[model samples]
Each structure stands twice: as structure tokens, then as C-alpha cells.
Target: MGILKILIIVTNINTYAIGNLETGLWLSELTHLYHEAKEKGYEITIASPNGGNVPIDPESLKRFTLDEVSKQYWNDMSFRALLENSKSLNEVESESFDLVYLAGGHGTMYDFPDNETMQSIIRNQYEAGSMIGAICHGVGGLLNVKLSNGDYLIKDKKITGFNWFEESLAKRKKEVPFNLEAGLIERGSDYRKAFIPMTSNVVVDRNLITGQNPFSSKEMAKVIMRELGKLK
Candidate 1:
């Protein structure tokens, strides 16, 4: 089989209004997946709503939170360039990739939902049978996607994202606009998560896959790879 082509979508929103918090793509969420995909010989492309210099969530770059892989990615100039020069969503074709990944951060809460171009790309990719994956708030991107059958993309699908408890635990309950868990439930998705918070939790339903938090990043990539028959 030819190398799998993957498109990674990141958030452009950099600051949260509450506490004026700094937010962007979680570095580990993107790096863990990118490292795994690269090792598996997959072609990876980074893109965003407006593209250009995708932000790394400030909190995620903290020394304590930085895992070895993420730290390596932070120092890798070549990899950094990919994030810096991500293609604009409008400029990429869905058919070119075999998989789509939504990297998470609080910032995604602001830009992932209700973007016509992002929705179109997702809709097209879904119809084309490409695998779709998202972690944390990145799953917000899937909320508004409606199929030609006039049903929400996640309707009746088993999915999970940043749960309500985690939001409150993170002390952003009032900061974020809406509850992601509630939104998924309202859209008819069978949302599931880890019994314990901040652990690796991933749910795969047909062509769609979702993770609960940044901790689920590597596991999410493994699931994607397994689905692609590239992992044992």
C-alpha cells in the first residue's frame, strides 16, 4: 500500500477571554501523533482555519507538562516550520489525504465550530471514507458537520471529547462558551470517556475516532494506525 496521507488541523485562536488565558494547539497532541505517523511512513500535512504560525498553547509548553516527544518536537526546527507554515484550510483538497486529525487546545473552542471551510473539508473527507480523528476541544470541529442526509455527522456515533467535569476541573467552566459533552449529547452522539479524568481515553466508531484529552494523544494515534493496518 502507498503511504498514508494525513492532514492535521490546528487552532488559530490564541487567547481565552476568561483570565485572558493563552491558548492554542496542545503541543503534545500534535507532536505525539506526528511522531507516530512519521515513524509509520505516513505523509503529514498541517493546516489551520487561517493557517500561518499555528500557536502552541502556552500552558502545554510548561516544563512539567512537556513530555520527551513534545519537548523534542518543540526544539526541532524543521518540524516547527510545518506548524509555522501550515496551509490554509481553503487551500487544501480533502481528496488528497487519507486521514484528517484535529489537534486540541482550549483555543479550538473558539474557531473549530461553525467554520464553513472546515465543515466542508470534514464532510468531504467523511464521504470519501477517510479516517477522522480529534482530541479534546478539537472534537468541537465535528459538532456542526451535517451530512447530505440532513443528519449531524456525530448523530448516533460513539464519540468523546473534553468532558464537562474536566472543564470545571481545569477551572474554565465559565470561561468556555458551552459544554462540549453537552453539545455532543445534544447532537445525538453517544459520548463516552475515561472513568478517571486526564487519562488516555479514545473511542473509535467506524471512520471516526476521538480522544478525551491531551493524555490520549499517543493512544489516539495508535488507534488510527491500527485502523489503517499500519500498527499491530
Candidate 2:
């Protein structure tokens, strides 16, 4: 097959709903997937719901929390420039990709769901046989997606995302607009979780891959690579 064309969508929300807490795209979530895909020479296109400067959650930049891969992208001015101007979902409607990745940040809780464009792209992409992946709150983008027959995309798919407890552990209970864990279960999704809290957990259900949190980025990227036939 030709090189896989990847579409990565990030959030444009820069604040929390309750306290206006600073939040945006989580740096590592994007970087891990980016570097892993870059290594295999897969083409990546970054976009957001609004198509402008993507906000970086302030907390994700804490020097103590960044991994080697995340740090590498942080120091590269060229990589940083990508977030400065992302394409809007409007521009991506006509495009088809081999993989559609949604990068998570707390800000995603503010905008990923109930988006007509987002739901349409996901439905179109998944139906077209593209690999669908999302990490942490990015999974929110998939929450409201319904297929043509009116079935939820994740209804019977085993999936995982930033759990409610993880949000509590992150001390963001009030900041989040909804309990993601409960929402998934409510939608008939077979949601799973990590054995431990604040750890990496990635669940694969056929074409869909969902990660538990920012910590799940590395493993999620590996899964994406494998799913794309880049790994054994």
C-alpha cells in the first residue's frame, strides 16, 4: 500500500468549563504519535475544530512530566510551528486519510463532542475503513458519533479513555463538563480501564484504538503503528 496518510485533530479550547482552568492540547499525546509516525515516514496533517493556533495545556509542559519523545518535539521550533496554524475540520471534510487520530487535552472536554463536522469525519473515515484512534480526552471526539444506520460507532466496541477517576485523580472533577467514563458506558460502549490509576492503558477493538490518558500515549502510538502495518 502507499504511505498512510494520517489526519490528526486537536482541540481548540483553551479553558475549562467550570473554573476556566487553563487547558488545551496535551503536548505529549501529540508528540508521541507524531514522532512514531515520523519515524516510519507516514505523512501527517494536523487540524483542529476551529483551524487556527492550537493551544497547549499549561500543565502538560511541566518539565518534570515530559518524556524523551515529548521533549524532543518541544525543543524543535519546526514541530512547534505546526500547532501555530492547523487546518480546520472544514478543510478536512473532502480529504480521506488512512488513519484518523484525535489528540487529547482537558480542553477537548469543551469542544470535541456534538460537533457536526467531527462526527461526520469520523463516521466517514471509519466507514471507509480507515484506522480510528484517540487518546484520553481526545476520545471525546468519538462520543457522539453515529453511523449511517444510527448505531453509535463505539456502541459495541471495546474502548478506553481518561476515566472519571483519573479526572478526579487529576483534581479536575468539577472542571470537566461530563464524566467520560460514564458517558461511554451509557452509549453502550464496552469501556475498559487500566489496572492502576494514572497509568498507560490502550484498548483495541478492531479498527478503533482508544487510550486511557496522556500516559498511554507511547503505547497507543505503538498500537497505531502496528495497526498501520508498520510493526510486527
Candidate 3:
């Protein structure tokens, strides 16, 4: 088979008073997807709401949190370049990828939901028979994407994301832009989640794959790879 073309969509956040400290994609999540896809000879195209240099949560890069693979991937010259030169949402065309994955972080809540460019990319990919996957707050991006038939793309599908209980436990309840689990249910999706403590959890429904948190990104990408290979 030929190379797999994968598109990773991230958020671009800018806090008015924080200087350049705004957060974008979580490093662990991107590390998971990037390495897994690269090992399988997949070409990656990263896009964001505003594109250009995307920011990352500095805390996520600390030595205690990330594994060696993640640490190495983050510092690689070529990989770093991809993050620096990401395509803007408006620059992505649906026909370019075989799969589209949404990487999550706190910043996603603000931009991913209402990005018309992203919604169009999802619609076009699904219509063209490509796989769609999101993890944690990344699923927030799918909240408003609709199909040509006038139905929410996630409607009636079994999906999972950062749960309400987890949010409460994080003590960041109010800081969250919106309630992810509740929003999924409100849209008629079968929102299911694992118990508290936010353990490793992943939900795959047909072509849609949703992982509960950054901890599940590796497994999530593996699942996506398996599903895409099956199609081939």
C-alpha cells in the first residue's frame, strides 16, 4: 500500500494578559499520534485555527510527565518544524488526507468548536470515506461539525471525552470553556465514560474514535491505525 496521509488539527489560543504563554496542543497527545503515524509510513499535515507557531502547555513537557519517546519527538528538528509551519484551517483541503485526528489541550475549548474551516474539513473527509478521531478535549472540536444530510456528525454515535467527574476532580471545573460530556449528550450522542480518576479509556464507534484523556493517546492512535489498515 502507499503512504497514509494524516492530518492533525489543533487549536490556537491567545490569552490577552498572559503575554506569549497561551496553550495550544498537548505534547503527549501530539507525540502519540505523530510517532505512531510515522512508524507506519504515514505523512502528517498539522493544521490549526490560526496556524503559524502553535503553543504548548509548558507543564506537559516536564521530565516527570512525558516518556522518552515524547521528549525526543518534541525536540526533533523536523518535527519541531511541522509545529512551526502548521497549515491554517483555511489552508487544508479535505482531499489531502486519509484520516483526520484532533489533538487536545485546554486551549481547544475556545477555538475548535466554532471553526467553520475545521467543520468543513471534517464533513468533506467523512463524505469521502476517511476516518475521524479525537481524544479528551479534542472531541470538543466535533461539537458543531455537521453532515450534508443536516445531522450532527456525532449524533447517535458512541463517544467519550473529558468527563464531568474528571473536570470536577481537576478542580478546574469553572475554568473549562464548556461541559464536554454534557454537550455530547445534548447533541444526541451516546456519551459513555470510564469511572473517576480519569484512567486510560477509549471509545471507538465505527469510524469515530474518542479517547478519554492524554494518557490514552498512544492507544488511541494504535486503534486508528488498526481501523485504517482494515479499510486498506
Q: TM-score each candidate.
A: 0.96, 0.97, 0.93
What is the overall TM-score of model 2 with all chains considered together?
0.97
Q: Which candidate gets the maximum TM-score versus the true structure? A: 2
CA RMSD of each candidate after superposition: 1.6, 1.4, 2.1
lDDT of 2 at 123: 97
Off by over 4 Å in 2: 230-232
TM-score of 1: 0.96
- Tell me how candidate 1 scores on lDDT: 0.89
Against the reference, the lDDT scores of all candidates come to 0.89, 0.91, 0.84
- Tell how far residue 105 is off in model 2, in angstroms: 0.5
Over the stretch 9-127, how does candidate 3's per-residue lDDT look in tens digits? 88777431234445567788888878888888888888898889877866578777677778998879888888888889887863568889999887888888998989999988887
- Per-residue lDDT value at 188 in model 1: 98
Report the lDDT tens digits of candidate 1 across residue range 121-158: 88888888888899999999999999878899999999
The residue ranges of model 1 lying beyond 4 angstroms of the native Cα positions read: 230-232
lDDT of 2 at 115: 86
